[model samples]
Target chain A: MSVIYQRVALIGLGHIASSMFWGMKASGLADEVTGYARSAETRETAREIGLCDRVCDSAADAVEGADLVVLCVPVGAMGAVARDIAPHLKPGATISDVGSVKRAVIEAVEPHLPESVHFVPAHPLAGTEQSGPASGFAELFHNRWCLLTPARADATEVAKLRRFWKGLGSKVDEMDADRHDLVLAVTSHAPHLIAYTMVGVADDLQRVTENEVIQFSATGFRDFTRIAASDPTMWRDVFLSNKDATLEILGRFTEELFALQRAIRQGDGDHLHDYFTRTRAIRRGIIEAGQDTDAPNFGRGAHSTGRAE
Target chain B: MSVIYQRVALIGLGHIASSMFWGMKASGLADEVTGYARSAETRETAREIGLCDRVCDSAADAVEGADLVVLCVPVGAMGAVARDIAPHLKPGATISDVGSVKRAVIEAVEPHLPESVHFVPAHPLAGTEQSGPASGFAELFHNRWCLLTPARADATEVAKLRRFWKGLGSKVDEMDADRHDLVLAVTSHAPHLIAYTMVGVADDLQRVTENEVIQFSATGFRDFTRIAASDPTMWRDVFLSNKDATLEILGRFTEELFALQRAIRQGDGDHLHDYFTRTRAIRRGIIEAGQDTDAPNFGRGAHSTGRAE
Candidate 1:
């Protein structure tokens, strides 16, 4: 792939930013990449790992003369970072973000961006539970969806960013920011919170020893534990910033959960069976779409090579 | 491994029963194995797949001369199956079950068993979302846990059954039946119900199209779908039989979820962050316990090989 941008600057060196740096170099998406993080420790780690061509001491310095700037901070901190680096952004630079929640991020960052710089917001529908500088690889975004939500003005910049994401091995699409938030609330946000809640409840139950829960996690509960282990600060900002959509989806989840609870209470096996059968169709669709493989016990089959017999 | 039983009979031709057949054969744990399912189609499929040494026409015929009779049916149907096979069970034979709910199964099965036959109930903490005779493999129980809830069980019979499970490549432990129900309610039953409800909610949401949910399931939601895709009949029976424990855990889940929702609504980042951070410890416990591998994306990383870059 050809270089989509002459120079790229990544603000907030976390999982997404670190992956972008490696991916850009691996796929030749950018000639040079500069990076900065709010914490000195993270900057030192990034520098040690050779995460960027140049590890800038400050966000403004990172964006100096860069053709594209990507804000990879938590959603709540995007406004402050945007304001801090707004004055130093080059006149023709394309500015974007990899925030999970789009509508709130655009609202937070758009006011601070200079008119000379083009802002195109993006949310990559990909990640692992791991975070921070050392937790990324060039293939983190491989075969994942990178949703671009560009409000208006700057078709060329949006196109270039889309190409750059494709270069990073992500399939790119465009959507309205509001729709992005709602879709993500259903697909990612609410599911995460629910998982967290389940794990928390399991941890808090005094009658059932925590040791027992950990040992007998089996299939279903272990999956929830993995989801619940995601970065605390990042998810915290996501729920707070994407409040309405996340809350709305969670409301629907509670209502449906209540209905299922009632069915269980009443011994409504037919209703439970029918509802469970319907959910299987959605899983099949996911496998058919190439989003996930059709492996049974998918979460942890690789590490177990059963007994010699 | 040497033969643990002269003849073993499986009372259902579903995933667990079929896997037990293959595992027994692979390890040479049973000299002869027979199988029976309530459905003719399943029996036909079992025969087609060579799932047993002999696929019997009825449960009675399956257990006629067997030293060990395993009831591998759903919990709700256990009593009926036990009643059907009782008179035909070999004298001094050990009858076991692989039901998810133990107390309910014991209540349903014990009264029907003859005094000469020893009842040693067992539950394998192993399986995949896929079901039916063909969906099982010899390695299904490899390195997994098989829990035995023996109630005044004959020492020799319980010992023999434990050895048989060990031959099938599972670690064996003895736990109380009522305690088993409560522990499983927290670890497996409640988590499964939660996953099913979340998937159902996602499928029913009108605002977000099912196509979008399927396509962009991302990580968190996709995990739920995999869990929710488990056999509907098995899950229905689990919930219906383990009613009190499951309902109690779900009640706790709703309370925790409500607290989290309130925190999100009030923008209490501290509460959310603290709660999420604590759950990570339990995940770490699962990893360190070797119940699950410490993979960042444990669900589906094996099949994704990135681009040329």
Candidate 2:
């Protein structure tokens, strides 16, 4: 509930950064928070929303006199943003990033940082499909997991960053960069690619009109659209940066899909039932872990006790 | 809200049937509702939940004097259940079904019905992952679409069924059996297959432990797990009965996936970005149609302004 960092700089204000700014202010996580975005319109919007204590014109100015500078840019642009801010970073400041892919981010950002500064890459495994400055709120990271790929960063600095995330209400954990990529590939990246592909296929279906898909999407395809509706630029960068792991997971997914397809073709009902039953346990695990609600229908009408679907 | 049917019989006491019984009671759509499940345990649960006005031991007994007999069994078992109940169905009674697939269900049920009985096939495009008698609730079908595929049923009977569904808080629509199958294949069947495959791949991945997958699944994969956790027997039957349409859509999905994969491999950010942006429009369309919530995070914490993730 007190200031952990005297000054925090958020480079590239977007959903994650804007949320971080509001969350920090709400929780008194820092004394002063500054922000900078490449686009003038975004910076102007940030000012209008009072998103930060100071809205700077450039990344260098935002990092000036800041004890912590967090890169919230797309994965592909992390390096450029790091290079832009490196010269103006305060002495002994910690530079962390909120990129989805950890290994690529470290590769992209660490080299540009001065040895006096700490480079710790962190990824909060939390997001909605919406993006931009206005689409953020203070509690986006609450109860979410923030994975830190410290990878030999100074222990004290890593602990401080972990504490800062904890103060923002995220449970912090550490994992190796490569393992993080593999885990995220299974949990996020490949699933996103699959959702994108499914939505695209639905969009292209001539027999099933787009209006019909939207109307009848409540069954299952609607969920895919929600995932597919995420920020295109960020997701594009995610796939490009986490290419190998994502492709590997997707290859395995295609293999599994083929086996299921063959089972359907062969009328192997038993195989399909067994596979479906096993997957149910994973959902139970997610609910038990508090990552998702256990209420029926994804908690759609949980609060409205007598309401219809 | 007056009773539309004097006596309505539900032949399978699963999620759909039990929900219908409760929904009928909620809206006074049926004066008396009776239900029968093949499994004694399900029958017991129905009684325990007070799911029906009468819980019959046999399907024949359930349909003995009913004006409307709804077959709520899985697609694969419709034929056998229809054969069992056809002998007891009242003269002039409308026998409809709540199966997901239409053409196969009609083929399976129509041949078993007597000339005196009216066979009207319908598919409710609604459900949650949970199944069994206890999972049913009166509000399950509220605002959801219920697609009727009445091939040659009496117009008056079809109108009555549509009114009954509307009384239960559903929006009613009609389509040809073949088109229904194709639309559902795109909207439900293929998406489910894709979800099952993604979850299966996550389960089989050795490097990413099961614990990690479940813990980090708060991202896009969690939604897939919810879809994959749906009633296995019902889904198995759906795939087997709707094989042609499902396969066609899945093939198209594979083609689209491979194209996107190639884009990702070739570092074609433009293609990925463009595709992802197009999908966002579909989500907007769904929201505009009132099929889904526009609140951030799919309305997860929409009611609680500052709730944790």
Candidate 3:
């Protein structure tokens, strides 16, 4: 396939940024790829690792003449990044992001963007527990869904960006920014919060159990541990930026959990069984829906390829 | 390696039972393996798939001359299975089970066992999100930990069983039944319950949003779905059987989760960040302790090898 963008600038050299760098490079979909991170050390690492064609000293400098500039920083940092780069953005350049929450991102970055630039907030629902420039792979986005919440903009620009993600092996879908946030709250945000909570519960119990939690964690808690092990700063910003929807989902989660607790306390086996069975069907639906692999490799000391250590 | 048991009988032809049959046969740890499930269809499947050396007609018939009789049925069925086969068990045979809750299995099975027979309760903390006779393979037990909760058993028999599991590529550990239940309550039982609750909450959301929950589940709710998708009968029996420990852990989990909810509601970003950071450390411990794998394959549609599909 021919290159889609003459020049693409990645404004954050983190996991998502680096992965996009590798993916775009591997697919040969961009004529030139430049990258910029806030930290000098990260920029040095990116250059040393050959993660970009040009490693720039500043976000504004990186996007000076680029057709596409992707903001890949933590959600809380979007406004500052947008403000810093708005003055240098090329006219008609399509500006997008890889933030987890869409509504907050648009609200934070839109006011700072130049009217000549197009802002499309997108989230590729693919990641590993690992983060950092060295942790990304070209195949990270393969077969994953990329949700785009576009503001009022040129249809051609949005379509071009969607094709960029599609070339990187992602299935693209578009929705309103508010609906995207609410959907993510149920799917990703609430689940992450619960994982964090359960891991905290296990950690607190470590004092009483004396590390037995880690030793025998092959059970269900091990799954939470994997999810909770994700980068703390990114998650903190995720919850903070997506506060309303996250809190709403958490309210529903707590209400359901309380009902389960009451059922357990009352020795209500039927209630437990019914709830468990219903949830089991949803798992089947997920599997049938092709959302998850049907594997129980939670705590097994093997990589995804099933190779044992 | 020599065969540890002259004849081994599996009382259920489900995932665990079929896996054990394949594992033992693959390792040459059992001279002959016989199995019986409640359904004739399962028995036919066992025979068709070559999951056992002999697909027996009755549980009693299967255990008549076995040197080791393993109860692989759901926890609620253990008492009945033990009672049915108690009269047919060999005088010096070792009777054990592969149940999730040790104390309950011991209580249910020990009462029905003859004094001449050795009764040991074991829980292999390995499984997949699939079930039935067709969903098993030889490598299911490889590198997995198998806990033997021996109750007044002869040291010779316990050693032999441990060797058998070791031959099948499992690391064996011994603990008291009560402690096993509590340890598992935190590690396995409470996690499954929480997963069930979260997935149920997602399912119960209005129909318009439930579809989004599945599509965007790659975030964190997807992990819960995998855990919640496990066998309903097995999990239900686990909660009902290990009521005390499960309830205790659930209480602790709810308290921790409520504290988190309060933190989020009040927009206590510090509390959220601290908790998220601490949980990340727990996941690090799990990785360092050699309890879990460290690769991200959340969206990869791979199947657990030994799971019966």
Candidate 4:
């Protein structure tokens, strides 16, 4: 884990940024790490937690001498942060982002970046429901996928950035920005919206008291809550920015849901059973791929013992 | 921890029955436990694993001389299991069930039970995605809720059954059968149907390769897969048996989902943020009530060590 970047600037002090800071320190991936956040309180918390070697008061100041600058803000705010920091970015610096949506972020931030700097929009496909400057650890990116969408970038710059993420213990892969949005819409965005809708439905049901829903949630609804409780602003922007893809996936979801509902109404047990059986293969595939564990109940007990909040 | 029943008969050696046997044995709540499954292979597994003191060949044989006969079969099969065991139960014996649906189970089972026996329908608000005798453990019911819906049973019989569940490390409460069905429809049945439909949609998406979906499932779809991978036979029966309540919840879910989808389409950030904030409160309630841990990532790391899959 030698230094991959002599100086790295993290332009948003949130979960991804703070985790990148700790991970870089843990792996010696950066000689010096500087961080900045728009909120005074977040910057103060970063200072208190020793989140970075230099907690810069301004985003421009943070990227002044850095060879790498990463925008770690929400999708909707990435443009403003990019514009604010563009003027101060060093020549030959590789500017990336950790936003969930790639196409929208690239469109928003690309115009503001200097032609001299290499802009490679990236997203690390790892996170928890928790956010903020304090809710990060060095292992957040370990063995996780980091999708890098380098738009006609220099090969040497792309490889260096790949090595930096690899140093943080991630498997780096390249994808087109449009394809990334569509894939994420299927994998993350639509699923989250569906979870949120389910939770909201349970809350709106008057017959089943909220107390009962929470008390008996272990059966299945608890998982929906975990996904629905994710950072609101980040998810809001994701759905808004990736509207067409999210809506398309969601439309398919509704159509499929209606089909299943008809099967239930028609008492088609075979249809339900066959559908359920087929989905189990995908779960097995996920486990075999090492993306998810196959312990019963998602292995909550092992992780929630002494360290759970 | 005293013996609540001299002999307890488990009429199906599946997850619930085996867990009950182990929990009862762990707490010394039953002098002897007898188990029987329709499948001879399951009986052999039970005997090999010492899941019960005696693994009987027939439900009638298992229920003989037992003061407590608990039907642990699917809801659709409860009536047949009840009729098979009724003639073999002791005069003052108590008959119970662990079916997820209550009203249909009561309708199916109550007529089959002898007048001398007490019919108490119960649903344990606990389970893992895994099934079968091998998946059972002594701590599966620890601190979980087990709802009992007694139909005009003697107070002594109901009290005894409650104590028996308490001995198994579950918090027991009584509710009307119809109300139990409604509450479960909101909490478990509907959420499961939604999870199943989402997983099925993910599988059916031709553009998104199955490998890609499996690899990127850590985002949100993985949780849906874990739930959708639950015992197909049991879930199919649940949906069919509890059709009315489940359909009701699904209707409400569709309505709420449409509202959220509209908000996303209209670029209504305020609507999305408000709804997300409200759902966060319910998650907090679940954590405070000890139904779920507040750990990030739903504590997947805790239970998903080397033992995953």
Model 3: CA > 4 A from native: A206-210, A295-302, A305-309, B301-309
Model 2's i-RMS, to one decimal, reads 5.6
TM-score of chain B of 2: 0.96
Clashing pairs in 1: none
Query: For residue A141, what is the lDDT in candidate 2?
Result: 86
TM-score of predicted structure 3, chain A: 0.95
Kindly list the interface RMSD, in angstroms, of each predicted candidate in the order they appear.
Answer: 6.6, 5.6, 3.9, 3.6
lDDT at residue B254 of model 4 (Cα atoms): 93
lDDT of each residue in B106-151, candidate 3, tens digit only = 8888889899998877888788787889887677777778999996
TM per prediction: 0.97, 0.97, 0.96, 0.97
lDDT of 2 by residue, B1-309 (tens): 888999999999988887898899888898889989999998988898798999999998999999999999999999999999988989999999999999999999888899998888888777777688987778778888899998788999999999999998889999999999998898889999999999999999888899999887756888788788888899899999999999999999988888999998999999999999998898789878877664554424433110000
Cα lDDT of model 4 by residue, B1-309, tens digit: 788999999998888888899899899999999989999999999989889999989888899999999999988899888877778889999999899999999988888888888888888887887788998888778888899999799899999999999998889988998888888888788988888888888888888888888776655777778788788899899999999999999999899989988999999999999998888888778878887665554424536421111
Scored against the true structure, residue B220 in model 2 reaches a CA lDDT of 82
Residue A237 of model 3, lDDT score: 86
lDDT of 3 by residue, A126-175 (tens): 88888878877888888789999986878999999999999998889998
For residues B1-309, what per-residue lDDT tens digits would candidate 1 score against the true structure? Answer: 999999999999888998899999999999999999989999999999899999989888899999999999989999999998999989999999999999999999999999999999999998877788998778778778899999899898899999999999988999999999999998889989998888998998999999999877777888788788888888999999999999999999999999999999999999999998999999889878877765544434552211000
- Candidate 4's DockQ is 0.55
